[model samples]
Target: MMDDFLTVIALIISLNAVICLYRAAVGPTTQDRVLGVNIVGTKALVVVVLVTFIQTESFFLDVALVYALLLFVVTVAVSRYLEAEGWKEVA
Candidate 1:
């Protein structure tokens, strides 16, 4: 029962991730695209964790950790790039 639930949730997450990926690809601005990328990365991380749990494997956890680290690095890089491009605090 629990496995079935996980499978369903995984499918949902995968679907949403794909949609977010499309958003990242077609965003009107770099900042919008970066935000979409961040969201997709986050969803991917969650899906990885769920797969690890469903399969009872430690290897997928390692993959998830690496992905999470990469996601962090990419998000930070995007923020730095935006800041460098004259994007300033709007308040």
Candidate 2:
């Protein structure tokens, strides 16, 4: 019973991730897109953890931890690039 409930919740989170992907694709500003991507990444991490529980596998948790770290790094790097004074877009 608990497993079924968790599976349902994971499905819901995956749906939200799809919505976040749309936001990332259509956001008017770089920050908005970055925020959307970050949200999607978080949702993905949640899904991974849920899978770890559902499947009784410990490896997915480790994967989730690594994914979280990568997500944080990417978000910080993008934010820094956006905030840099002299960054230029290449045509």
Clashes of each: 0, 0
lDDT winner among the candidates? 2
* Residue pair clashes in candidate 1: none
TM-score of each: 0.84, 0.91
lDDT of 2 by residue, 1-91 (tens): 9999999999999999998899899888878899999999999999999999999999999999999999999999999989999877532
Q: Could you tell me the lDDT of residue 4 within candidate 1?
A: 85
TM-score of 2: 0.91
Off by over 4 Å in 2: 88-91
RMSD of 1: 4.4
The top-ranked prediction according to TM-score is 2
lDDT of 2: 0.94
Model 1 gets an lDDT of: 0.90
